[model samples]
Target: MRMRASQVLALQSHFESTFTHRLKVFLAERLPEARGALAGEEGLARLEARISVARSLGFRGERDACKYVTLSFLLGEDFHEAHWAAAALVDPRHRTPTDRAEALWNAAKQRELDEFTTESVRASD
Candidate 1:
């Protein structure tokens, strides 16, 4: 079934509001904490700490929650990568949306899964 342009646009808007917008806000707010966590601990301690921070934001949907969790793992890494990447990430920047979204994709791909994610994979195996 093909989606109409209107439906596609609406879905885009929904993701913008629910996942992207909230994530950017949360990242901005908790950046320092995320940076701190980079050096604090590893394994479940760091992963759970990131999830705990996400829970504090009150996101309540499957897609949003999934994004939050994945991003929780990637945020610190993404921040550092984006700092050096060709993607110019800042306000009043060219292609901010594309740049940021692409950065997240790269981050997700490059992330080293925490114990929770690894356990799920192992369980499935």
Candidate 2:
């Protein structure tokens, strides 16, 4: 069946709204610490904006964009620009957006592990 342009637009809008809500719920569940920040109307707006920024940064897939938002919460919004390893994390050599996001995520985890190990050593000293 051929749908009119207005009908197609409405369907697209509805899908976007549903997808955004689902992403919010998933993020809230995965990031308990961010529950407060991800609550209420303002939170939805922030999430939408972050998703937009993620897309702008080459996170093409919804899941990849979600990962980007997760990274923002975990590593700070400007991590790509301000992190000590920012150059490597955002390097254009990655084959795809998924690869770049995965690399960034792994690097963030390694950074946390390194910090934790360093702190432990200092505490034992």
Candidate 3:
């Protein structure tokens, strides 16, 4: 039997809600600092907004989307517009959202490595 448009939309909404909740719980479990940072309605709304932004940026895969949100939480939600990694993410040569996401991830990883190396050097001084 064919489903009505309303039914299809309802089903899609339910799926999205479920996925969002699952993502939130997964992030909370993996990032303990988020336990207090992301509590109740306001936090949920903020997370949902960040996920929406991630999807718009072409992070359709669950893992990539999660990474986007994680970075947003770490760097601030507006990081896309201002962060150094934003250069990699918006580079025209990337040619695809997945490519942009990968570039962003690499930039973030490199930044982490650079910070660690700097801290190590400082410690040894």
Candidate 4:
């Protein structure tokens, strides 16, 4: 489901450590109902677009995007796309150097996960 711009803004407003904790709970509450509605590439694309919009609207931090991407991936969305999106959002040009480094680290880890998932999928096929 495409989240409204206003809803995204609301999320950004609460992008703090406390809010992050709360958001996790919020997602946990809604995940079961929403997970089945989003599947495959379409779901991945929507999530990427949502993060893009959040950034464009001045959400200038990696944590929230990272959390969202992590949650989405855990919920069976495309981890590869989510990983890249999170990486790009925290890129040095877009965020602090420390954040960039962290994002790069996360990107590397996600890449590893992606490779594993790809290999596993191929094996299954």
Task: TM-score for candidate 1, please give it.
Answer: 0.27
For candidate 3, write residues 1-125 as lDDT tens digits: 99999999998888776877887898798888887767898878888999999999888877788888888887778887866777988789999777777788788888889999999999999
Listed per model in order, the count of residue pairs whose N, CA or C atoms clash below 3 Å is 0, 0, 0, 0
RMSD of every candidate to native, in Å, equals 13.4, 3.2, 3.3, 12.4
* Model 2 residue pairs with clashes: none
Candidate 2 residue lDDT tens string, 1-125: 99999999998888776877888898889989988888999988888888888888888787788888998888777777865447555687877988888887887888899999999999999
Give the runs in model 3 whose Cα sits over 4 Å from its true position. 1-13
Residue 88: error of model 3 in Å?
1.2
Please give the distance, in angstroms, between residue 55's alpha carbon in candidate 1 and its true position after superposition.
0.5
**Judged by lDDT, which candidate is best?**
3
- Which scores higher on TM-score, 2 or 3? 2
Note the Cα lDDT for every prediction shown.
0.49, 0.82, 0.83, 0.55
* lDDT score at residue 86, model 4, on the 0-100 scale: 58
Q: How far in Å is the alpha carbon of 61 misplaced in model 2?
A: 0.2
User: What lDDT score is found at residue 40 in candidate 3?
Assistant: 90
| lDDT for each residue of candidate 1 in 1-125, tens digit (9 for 90 to 100) | 99999999999888745553454345546665554444433533554454554444443443434454555455552342353333333334434344443454554454444556888999999
